[model samples]
Target: MSAFLMENKKLLLDGSVIACVEQRDGEWEDTFICMGENMWLWNRTFTVTDARESWDDFPMEFILQGEVAFYMIPGVNYNGNFWGEGKEPKGLLDDGIPWRFAGHRSGVRAGMLAQTKEAAVGIFAAQENPMGCSMEMERAEKKGFCMRLHFPEQEGPRVYCARDSYEAGKYMETTCFCKKNLVFSAWIVVREPQKQHDYAAFLDKAWEVCREEGSVRLLTDEQVWELGMDFAKNRLYFEEDGFAGFCMGLTWKDKGWEQKRDYLEIGWVGQNASLAVSLLYEYAIFGEKEALRRGLSVLDVWCGRAALPNGLFRCRFDQIRKWGGRIDNDEERNDAANLYSAVTELLEAYHLLAELGIERKLYRKTALAICSFVTQHQLESGKMAKAWFNDGRISDAEGTVGCYLAEALCFGWKECKSREFLNAARAGFSYYYKEFEKYGYTTAGALDTCCVDKESAIPLLRCALELFEITGEREYLEAAKQVSSYLASWQYHYNVQYGGHTLLGQMGYRTRGGTSVSVQHHHIDCYGLEFYEAWKKLAKYTGKEIWRERAEALWENALQNISDGTLVIKGQKRPRGSQDEGILQTRWHTKRGEYFGVSEWLVAWNTAFRLKILRKDFLARKREKSKEEKRIS
Candidate 1:
């Protein structure tokens, strides 16, 4: 066994220090120890490992002797005035999509630069990893500019996406993953100052050297699942009344454009269409009637004065102060309009619940009325605006309301066999074809800036495929393939932060796969996870498993974003302003300048959506298998 340490007080602020230890032949585990006024003595190992091309249930470990981890060679470095996160990096890349890790929007960030002017390897907070660690860059230090990354033996809770969490400086221990033993891991590529360093090339070379050692072994799928469950068993959100279940949308302090930080003072009195959808899943998952009761309660809240006489739910409850369904606060106008999303979710859930031997007459009535509303007011242009007021006049249409309407009409026609619904859907397809003719597969999103938005694009993609499935129109099927291919183009191929929230480190981010760019909100949302589901369906429709491969890669990356409920994990009711268990937020990666509307808020609906997708995928595959078996027979 061999151990080594390097300390350079001259490299950082007073008391700031950096050190590393390595043993070539030992268990595959590695830890980072950093200390100083500018640095914290934080300990992080690759928390999750065992990748089979993409993230797999089985984690495969290796025993090695002379492997490379990373390097920040101090003595020999070259030119650029200062180099850190680039607008776009050549090796580890993030093209500023909504699926980016938090805080990585102002370009590729969370890196350290050894500036010639400062003569210090200054660690800048790169925001591409999880929110569990923190550092303070104090440029006003009289003695000297100090970049401090302090790690307390016992740190506070993980900060969220709100303004306060951004202001509260700290790191979550579980944010980054690095569970490997390293004999040769250093920071900064050691080379002559002017020489070029090809990170991708070096990484390939490193892997080659290790592979030659015969130390690597593959893991079976069963092993992958066993390992993941082993970790899952210890998670807090799995318990009842866990953090995720409390305040479903926990309060946080959001400092809007104002310079002062203020707490987000809002109580979630229920009545969110999205939450209703989630409760249905909670019932399905745990067979709890209480879950269904909570869901019905949410739907019930929207009734009475909150809804129009026609049963259209208001976007925000004046009494509860929560806005969702199709009408969310992200919209600048028409705070009260009926959304295709709200209508569709209610209709689908009503149908599913009715099948489960539980029927709510009000829900059925409301859903049926929304269907009548769609057919009653058909757009000549074959598209509906994103929102319509109680009077049935278009209030907000720029937000891709048409996409939702298109699907709603299709599903409505299938459910009620309304020729009017089918005609409306047909008209919408014509509009889509015109767009296809003009711009290929990238259709108009909710806004003009994004020609291809995941928000609208997802529904549009599904609409095309569903239309094809329903009508067997070659045109719709062809359109589905085009839209599917275009959506696939926007996928994030790499993680820029692999070594979890550490500067000049490779662990947390630096791992990639999911990120979407469109006119919708410019932040990660669990809804984006649908990209995978869409791809899988397209694969089934187009008869090309290649689409499923793409779906798997994106899904694996998305898995990194899902977190269990917070209440149980954190051990208290979001102590002050931190996350609790059950608040799943796997929408990592954020492009700068997009509205992270409730980006940090717990969205259990996303988990439910994913579960729904998994079931749909499983059933679809089963159906295909049944068909194949029949043909074979």
Candidate 2:
């Protein structure tokens, strides 16, 4: 038999010190002498004879100790019991005898005669509680050594410490401590080495296969252009035609495949819209006269004129142009008016273009048409809705309609300097608040009254924040805060089976009468993280620190589950099964959840907005710091 020992004080794992030991001589025995501060000790002792002769039947023994409880790995089979509540020996292994253990363990194997120095173990420590302990190992080996330890604070304030040493056939002792109790986890992974293959040659063959498969004809020109722009933005290779189209349209049949597939699928459309708008803005703002003119021509084709009579412009072809069965008794009219509010964004784009002195006749005509339609539709309550189909009468004002009206009115107020438009905008904002005040600034029901009790509280909250920004009204700010508070109260907390807060724990599900159904019962369209970001901004702007903190926590939790650069949608509530129909199945059962596809777009937009607000905050902080430095000087 052989024995070895190696120690380095500087090498740490998650913030905890780790020491590895190997038994070489006859069966070796060791008892944990002491437990250190913020430390966890795990021992895996295997017989050398069995390991060498019958490698498959290697008899291994493991002992683990921590400040509080010992959590067994998912597949390791062992029995343990806790002796005391505080400073107690926990786990069946703590019963003063070796606990029976059996499992097909596969991981790093240490040779009995080999003594190699390895990095120290580290762990994440709790902020307030400081715990320390030590473990003593008895073996047939000799000599003890120590190394350096370092703990670096991360965004989550998690830390790690490690040490290494090299000695054979010796007893080992390790001591570790931290300012707080550390909660850290690590896993052992096992995988077979891959066989040699010619990746370059494989790719060349794949290209031939792709061409033969007729994959070149799959993507449209717009898609190809969007692909190029995205590649340019990321500094990735710009593939023209076949290469770009194939990469953007690939799909698979499994969960992993679904994730990659949705990215390519959604990216095809989203990237196009983003690239088109960005190009137009860039040209309008910074391009030369000729460049601006070229950009404008492209924008005109990409952002086609609305087919509906309502003066709204269609930014993309995918947006439903006509909500059929609507219009006054006159001939069938185009449906672009449904998205009248989106016209503000287009106008903003045009304004940027105008700044570059790129004058276009259509720009003025489109802008004026939108303004006139908004003016004509203003109702006495300061609310406006285009006439409903099959009925010439104006529809009742509510829900998303209020959001649209408020946005459009705000735009009109900006351009026309008309009190009527501003008043109408204010009234629409007020109407929404009044209707859903019971829900605490949340929208009470659908704008079109399609659903009975489902409230679009998120959109309403968003609109309220925007209104507050435009008007600087304290009431709007207060409404936003209340809505944010309502949302926080609904966050999921603990496991439902574990008696934890239900709503905020697993998923954010739609509720009626305080009862939430399974996620499978509802459409996943409501899933969005932007509302949290908006709340964070509202909190910072209004000096509501608590709201900001809560928003931060929710954001962190959501971000943790992102896999393959995509957010996973877990059960917000238990899935209700397949009863819920009409919704796209692709959007459901998505590994990242159905919302994964659109989440990037929403996250990007929200982040852009938040960054603008944060920039202001940053500047204020810098100014204050400078003033303080001057005073000190």
Per-candidate TM equals 0.50, 0.41
lDDT of 1 by residue, 141-243 (tens): 2333322322211112322232212222233243222434212222221111121121222222222222222211123323332322222122211212111
lDDT of 1: 0.39
Q: What is candidate 2's lDDT per residue for 1-633, written digit by digit as tens?
A: 111122331223344433433334654332221123222232223333333443212222221122211121111110121211122122323224322211101000110010112221221111111111111111212322211111111100110010011112111121222212223111111111111111111112212222222211223323333333333233211223211211122122333221121221111112322333444543433343543343444345433433235654332232222423233333322122233423454465566556556555455456556556656666666555523332323444333334554655666677767787677677766766565542222222332222212224454566677778778888887777655543432332211111123322343321111111111122222223446567678768877565554454344333221122233433221111101111111112222333212222122222222222233334346568879999999
Regions of candidate 2 where Cα sits further than 4 Å from its true position: 1-275, 279-298, 302-304, 307-310, 313-341, 360-368, 382-401, 438-455, 466-472, 489-529, 550-633
Query: Judged by TM-score, which candidate is best?
Result: 1
CA lDDT of every candidate: 0.39, 0.32
